[model samples]
Target: MTIEWKGVMPAVTTKFTDQDTLDLQMFEVNINAQIEAGVHGIILGGTLGEASTLSDEEKRILVKTTVNIVKNKVPVIINIAEQTTKGAIEAARKAEEDGASGLMMLPPMRYKAGDRETVIYFKEVAKSTHLPIMIYNNPVDYKIEVTLDMFEELLAFDNIKAVKESTRDISNVTRIKNRFGDRLKILSGVDTLALESLLMGADGWVAGLVDAFPAETVAIYELQKAGKIKEAIAIYRWFLPLLELDINPKLVQNIKLAEVATGIGTENVRAPRLPLVGEERKTVLKVIENGLKTRPELPDYKNSDLM
Candidate 1:
């Protein structure tokens, strides 16, 4: 499957059993739901997918499982959030070998690399892989900004093809467009900012909450593209509260709770991280319940010829 680098590509959560093993069954269920809801691609082992805690072997299994499940209907992408350049390269090569169509990579984690070092790390990894890459430019959360100058240097690499724009500054979408034109595809990484970013000319959405509400997420993107602004805005307004959960510190837990409410997933998270509980869990659940109760009837955006 060739990655078009457009449309809704979910950064899906890594499903785990109560014993903390990969729950391939539930993972398949969610991936199937995303594809059925009209998402463009599957991203495995991302921030939402709990990349840091997953073993290298587990990540490979996820890529392979998604590849088989998606069966070439859509591209399966793996996220590389390694702490070292060598590790990142190895992960990229392994993902390609595991049949991933593309990669969504973060800047070298833990160590805050300066501009030169960051660019070097990305270039070296790009040099190592044949697969198309989407640089996860999430300076707000990751703390290492891949500024335009660094991007200019990275422009020499043909495979460094796109960016997951999560800076939270909506204007960065236009800044990227102005600087690179169509040289790099920009996918809005922040959930709450997705529609606005799309309106600002982002090529796609690297969506987080689509794990729970895939249909609503895809509808917003498809409707916006089809020039149905009034319909899109109606859903977007109702979706804002649930979308806000993605920006929280406990986003994985919060979204998994939402998934549980929707009956598509479980709330089991690997430790060091745990499932939401007590008042916090109650608060998140209220938001999810409200969204579910008032879930809007979607127009036939999927069948729109305009898209």
Candidate 2:
């Protein structure tokens, strides 16, 4: 569907201190850089941001910090998802009260079985908040399959405006775009499939790599929007490999490491998630180096660049 949101909105990470507390300063620093680089939008408290581990206070800080830093320059969607419908609604209500532009909500986690029960779960959460909600479809991470029919049913509610589809199945992107094309906002969740999804009629994407390289993300969208497919493809090819790491359980640390490697943001992460080391760190660094070599104009690694 034609809508106000589109293109390379990174699932922004929440920076933290070694003590595992929220690093509000670095959060502002990173968010401001993404905004200045011209991302189509910004997302706070998404999976890539490790929203699962953050406390309610921390989540509130994330929403307020992001909304203030963005200052309405681009769309800022807050992830208001929890294990309970009440918690999710509370988070969504808080984000709305704090002035977030939109909300991306995940299904209730920590449960098992039954599609009918799942439907009721969604119905309850949907009823709790008035904010525009993007139903997150991420079975890979959450272990719950939010089916196409379920999504269609959710659409009966007027506030369910968008979706983050990440089944790792590109065809579903086409399916959602085709089936719900007239009704919901279809945002391809995987960064690697941004190109395919775009051509397949997805209105936009929520990218993980955009955290480390907002300029490149914005460039790909701009190039394609200008009908420069070849240029856009080049950018996508360079990012596809790194983007795949978003599927990795180590996504938060991986993107943070990429930030450290490129001076985009801190590699600082909360525990029990340790910093990457040994072969893992080496592998991630190589990806960053090659990505930089492929596009040197994409800002050199420098402290000044992050701010």
Each model's TM-score, in the order given? 0.99, 0.91
Candidate 2, 1-307: lDDT as tens digits: 1126666687888888777788888778778878877777888888778887888878878877777777778877888667776676677778878777788877777876367777777777668766677778888877788898988788888878877877878888777767777587778887777888777777778988788887877777766666667767877787888787776878888899887766767888777788899999888878878877786354321223332
Q: For model 2, what is the error of residue 55's alpha carbon versus the real structure, in angstroms, after optimal superposition?
A: 0.9
Model 1, backbone clash pairs (residues 3+ apart or across chains), number: 0
Q: Which candidate is the best by TM-score?
A: 1
TM-score of 2: 0.91
User: What is the C-alpha lDDT profile of model 1 across 52-137, one tens digit per residue?
Assistant: 89999999899989999989999999999888999999998999899999998899989999999999999999999999999999
RMSD of each: 0.8, 4.6
lDDT of each: 0.93, 0.77
The parts of candidate 1 lying over 4 Å away from their true place are: none
Candidate number of the best lDDT:
1
